[model samples]
Target: MKTLLLLEWMKVRKYKTFWAFIILFAISLAGINYFIHNVQIQTKSLTHGMADIQIFSFPQIWSTTAWAGGFSVLLLGILIITLVTNEYSFKTHRQQIIDGISRKQFISGKWLTIIVFIIFAWISYFILTLIVGNHTENISVFSGFDYAGYFLVKMAVSLSVAFMFALLFRRSGLAIALYLVYVFILEGIVKHFLDKIAGGLGMFLPLSAGGYLVSNPMRQAIPGIETIHIQPVWILLTCLGYLILFVYLSYRYINHADL
Candidate 1:
């Protein structure tokens, strides 16, 4: 474990683009959360029962902020893909094998990066959780910090998707483009039609399943409580299955394909 982490650190330490990505991800997360906080503040003015309710309030903070913050996991996913593909672009993947690192170890290094990215992203949310909870209009001493676990799983699922793409394409530009298209367009269209044909079962699509895991509350989010809302344990299990599949496929590509 320590050696794998050391290898990952060696790759990340001097990489300016990696640092840029980390900085960008942090700023984007904070910016998005701030935007949501302000939007909630403004919405409170409207004459509706929903107004004056803050998602960051203590009890709801875990789930509400997680659902709100989950969107930025895509950025983290892209960074992971880029970091992996950059090795190939630089031919450093070949050199690493020349330097006596086994293919399995190389893949392990990449996997370590995924673990680290997820951890950093989760820590960022933890800090934001404190900040958002501190300044929100209401407080109740926090009922369910358990929902943060769901947020972490959602992020792992997102990063795993990117890892699989990077392994398959081996080119950052093409891989990232395909990932976005699949997530935003292809999946959207297919899920729409599939939902109609398969009943509500279409919600179990890879991305949709992750969304269901830390689903938004009925009050703050647009989706009806009955529709987007799913039992977290089931969604968690489903997403973990997807995550395992993604990692296994990526590992196979890395393990079997010539560098």
Candidate 2:
């Protein structure tokens, strides 16, 4: 276990590009927060009515964190995908195998690092929320707590997704590019089609359904979309299913994959 951790740490330390992503993550979050703050300032009067009333009686932190961590997940996904893909792209995996690092340990160590970073990002995001808004207005301690939980679970799910993508593509650039395309383009288009075909069932599309567990209460309250208000229980189940399915698939693939 110690050796696996050490190896993962070494991978992180030796990679400058991977480190560069931290700056990008910070910048993206800052930009989003700045935009949201400005909009809030302009519309403060309109939104003041909803401040005290808690819309989400059965609030799931996972949903809140997923909303806040949306951008973080995008950034982290790219980083993780790249990190895993680069190992294969650079032939580092073969060397690690040669050094007697079992595939299971390698996968476990990477996942451990991912979990640590996910927690760090979640805390950082919650802190940023507090920093960007007044403590009494536009913010609540419960909201922060809820979002933190969401971010942690979202990170776990995203890590599993990244692991699968990395193992499949085995090329950092390809994995990252594909992920970006899927997020920015494919998901939007696919979701629309699915929504039409399956009617209400389409709201349960993998990413969209997982999204329900972590979305902001306000955003989740938009009218006319009946299925959008997926119950917290359903959201939890969907997320769990995705996590288990992807982890099992990635594990099987990585275990049998030729370095």
Candidate 3:
């Protein structure tokens, strides 16, 4: 696994765009959280007892950061698509195999890179939560491990879908644009109409199931907010199911492609 990661790193080590993504993801992650925390502090102080809501207070803070952190996964998605599809675009994917790496190893190396993204994201969330929890409130670091766990799993699913899209499309720009369209516009539209005929069906969509994983507690407090409630277990199962399908199909696609 380490060797696979090394190989993948060699490919992107000098890639300026890759570095730009790292910087962007990091800055955006921290910046957005800092912005939201400030907003929460300002507005909550005006409301009686809202200050004690624990939005950024330790245990609950873990979940809050997780929910916010999910937004940046879109960046990672674009990153993976650009990186993987670039291999095909530049014809280096074939060269890697010509240089003695099997096709399976080639795919594995890319997968390893995605796994690193998942781990890096998890660690970022853990560290940010740790720092904020310590300064904001006295709380157990491990109190909401379950939420953290779901965060990691949902991220894995998100990355897998991105990776699969990269493999299928092999055109970075198209893949990234299509991914955004499907997730932000296409899926939402499909879900909106689907919900009218069959309640709770939208929650089963790939992105929707992932959203069900890390919930925003603030949404629950809002009156007249209509949202479907599904069991976390079911949502998780749905996510895992999609993860498996995506990986299998992506693997099969690349394994047999003419690249």
Candidate 4:
């Protein structure tokens, strides 16, 4: 298993796309921080009036990291999809199979890469949060752990779902674009409609539930639909279901495919 992991790590290290993604993620976070900094300057306060506006702040900079990384989940998903298809793109997976690496090892290696990247992405959020400003005294024992855990779980599910889409489509860009549509567009509409019909029940869905977990608490006290008040247990179950299903399908697909 260690040998397999080492070989996979080497492949990831050598892949230009992986490095390109890291660079992109960094640039994006920096760009968002810059924009948020400007907005903070303009407002100069967390709220405007009874309007209860959701204000951006330096202390909340981690949310920018979360947004950037969360938005990039589709890209990561596409990357995962492409990793497999790229074998066909480069005629490598077939050769690896011929060289005695089982399909199981190949699939496991890809999953390990995804999990490693997921951790890196979350850590990127944490480091940026520290850079932004102060941690509020309101942070409780459970609040801090729960907030962090929620962020990590949402990221994991997003990446896993992206992998599943890639497995289904086998084309990186198309699969990723589809994933983006689901996240940014389709889910938005669904949540809006659900909010009208069921109110807080929308929190049960992945995006809505995740919105509840990571949303700035102060922002939630204000008016407008409260997508951020989701229960931790529901988000946990939804994310876990996604992770398991994606991993299972990844194995089943690769094991049975014509490859």
Cα RMSDs, all models: 2.5, 3.9, 2.0, 3.7
lDDT-superior candidate, 2 or 3: 3
Off by over 4 Å in 1: 48-50, 134-142, 217-229
Which is the leading candidate under TM-score?
Answer: 3
Measured with C-alpha atoms, the lDDT of residue 36 in candidate 3 is 74
Q: How do the residues 1-259 of candidate 1 rate in per-residue lDDT, one tens digit apiece?
A: 7987898898789988888888888888878777877777777656464556557677677777787767677887888889889989999999989999888888888888888888988888888888767553454555677788888888888788888888889999999999999878888898889888987777778888877767755355543445555677777788988988876877787777888
User: In each prediction, how many residue pairs overlap at the backbone (N, C-alpha, C within less than 3 A)?
Assistant: 0, 8, 0, 1
Q: How well does candidate 2 match the true structure in TM-score terms?
A: 0.83
Where is model 2 more than 4 Å wrong at Cα?
43-66, 137-140, 216-227
Candidate 3, position 171, lDDT:
95
Model 2 agreement with the true structure over 1-259: per-residue lDDT tens digits: 7778788888889678877888788777667655544544445456664433233222333243346557766887888888787777788878887889788777777777777777768777766655544444444546546556655666677666766777788878788887777766787788889878886565565666656556554454345645455576776677788887886776687799776
Give each model a TM-score: 0.90, 0.83, 0.92, 0.79
- Predictions in order: lDDT: 0.80, 0.67, 0.83, 0.67
In order of lDDT, best first, we have 3, 1, 2, 4
Residues 1-259, candidate 3: write the lDDT tens digits: 7787898888889989999998898887887788878877766777765544667776777778888888888899899999998998999998888998888888888888888899998898888888776443455578877999999888988888888878878999899999998878998999988888898798898887887888775675466888777789998899989988987887787688898
Native-referenced Cα lDDT, model 2? 0.67
lDDT (Cα) of model 4: 0.67
Count: clashes, candidate 2 = 8
Mark the regions of model 4 whose C-alpha exceeds 4 Å error after superposition: 45-68, 72-75, 135-145, 190-202, 216-222, 226-229
**For model 4, how does the per-residue alpha-carbon lDDT over 70-182 read when each residue is reduced to its tens digit?**
65555566677667567666777788889999998888877787888788877776676566644556643223344556778877777776667766776667776787788
